[model samples]
Target: MSTDTNTVTALPMRPVVADVLREAADADPRLVVLGADGQALAAGVRERYPERYIDVGIAEANLVGVASGLARAGRRVVVCAMAPFLVRRAAEQIRNDVANPGLDVTFVGVGGGLSYGTLGPTHHCPEDLGFFSALPHTRVYCPADVVDAAWAVRQALAVPGPAYVRLGARADRVVHAPDERFDAGTGLLMRPPGRALAVAAGAGVGIALDAADRLAGPGHTLGVLALTAVTPFPQERVRELAAGVDAVVVVEEHLASSGLGAATALALAGQWHGAFAAHSVHTGYPPIGDREELLAHYRITAGDVAASVLDAVRGPGAGARR
Candidate 1:
């Protein structure tokens, strides 16, 4: 419910996940919440519905297998686990069990991208979007804040197929209003339309918004697009926005070749002649550091992203840098 775009609330989205799961469980008795060493995050659900909650320890593979089995048995299942382990550890189980049969399973992966910070690359999950989006009968969501996270949880539950919700560790940036209307497969424009657009997802949305704000001036208007939904890539909306923009920059906390930036580039392929730049993590297994340190290391900060956008907007014959 915060309107301040400059600051983020601590532990906002994490509690919202538990609340959403509790509410869904209240509405449907068939709803079951499973945790892969994530019981603490879903403690509320365990307390409220003991019969419907299961903690599978650190066995992420077994977590997916159990969830898939329950889903096949006509149960609404949600798997809450660390992002990297959930997406990478149980990838095969997810593909063969949940995605193949198209079961009702929602995987809530916390600490996506470099959210794990100093935890090392084994805990970082920058490849989840590519892995999940490539799966059939699967939908991927990368929410920006608590509002988007809540919506993703609800949407993943409402849908009757396998879904993945990659969330930040504790980022609660207020990118959207409390009552923001969200339509799946459609990116939300956080700023007014401009000559250039900064498309981003997850934690990068706030950075993109900041970059857009920093570039706002007499003739340097930049729009910020928040792509909460990854799979079912909002091709039409992206194309529509790209048609009016002179340049496009994709800022994300993922690998440049396999994240939102890659998706955006592909969506605009064979069309949209504007200059484009994808400002994302370009290296693998970055050095150990906190979230901010790591983002700075990868040059994914707001300042770096703003510079990239300006460079793209001011490409050859696009006028000198302001």
Candidate 2:
């Protein structure tokens, strides 16, 4: 995140995705968009480049197959659908057809995490990172806002192998500048350096930012590290940021076991000998509610994040040296 106040603007990620794909289609005939009857969200691309868009009508498995086939035929395909179905229902196709063969396929999973909260567990997706990252030759990204999402879309178009871009259903508050540089396998520092560092991904970046502000009210300053890319986890960057911090707290919407928390812990293993706390959705199915309710239920709110950081910094067990 840049300190320059005039550079950032909040916007919805859905239209940003549509605009990026449509522009890519216009520039390159090789680019194609595929959907699983989810054209409502991608109406921009469908209306502009109808010939390049394909609606698979709720068939997630068939959708991946068609995208993979097109990629194999020298086409860059972008598969758009809800995260739960796109990643879970079409797991085999993604693993065997796209990742295994190293196809130029980009799976854009919308409504990531509890964005589809009212639809129940079947519609919620918190395991995409776990499953997708486990596969070989695949790249995974969860952008914080429209700017990062656009950059990710462009990167996916140029990358040689398979990639997954997880997005939320609603708009996100801007945290980075429009001109912020994005690269795979890298992390961004959203706030100034502090005694404690909070690592977050996707929507959680905003949450962590809010938590940092809340902590400031109590005479505490916490730094925030935003991770736009999940797979090919930025280990070196994590270590570099973790250095000099009294404690590190990782917050995410996904389950702690396989989400950014797990990735950060793995990255700092044997290197960062400091207190750590993980704030994320637990390892069980969450109760059905709206996004806010579910986030509160899982204690993924800004207040909870601030409390966790406070605990990690001054708790009974936080007596170790950095």
* Model 2 CA RMSD to the hidden true structure, in angstroms: 3.0
Give TM per candidate.
Answer: 0.94, 0.92
In the range 1-322, model 1's lDDT, one tens digit per residue, is 2222545554457888888888999999999999976775587779998989999888988999999889988999999998898888899999999998899999888988889888888888888888888899999998988898999989988888999998888655667877998888677887865778888898788887777778878566878888888788998899898788778888888887888878899989987777788878876568889888888888887788778767766668453322
Scored by TM-score, the top model is: 1
Please write out the lDDT profile of model 2 over residues 205-225, one tens digit for every residue: 888888887777433578888
Runs with alpha carbons beyond 4 Å of true place in candidate 2: 1-10, 217-220
Question: What is the Cα-based lDDT of residue 139 in candidate 2?
Answer: 89
* lDDT values, one for every candidate: 0.84, 0.83
* Candidate no. 2 TM-score: 0.92
Displacement of residue 130 (Cα, Å) in model 2 is 2.0
Residue 114 displacement (Å), model 2: 0.5
Q: Where is the poorest 10-residue window by lDDT in model 1? A: 1-10
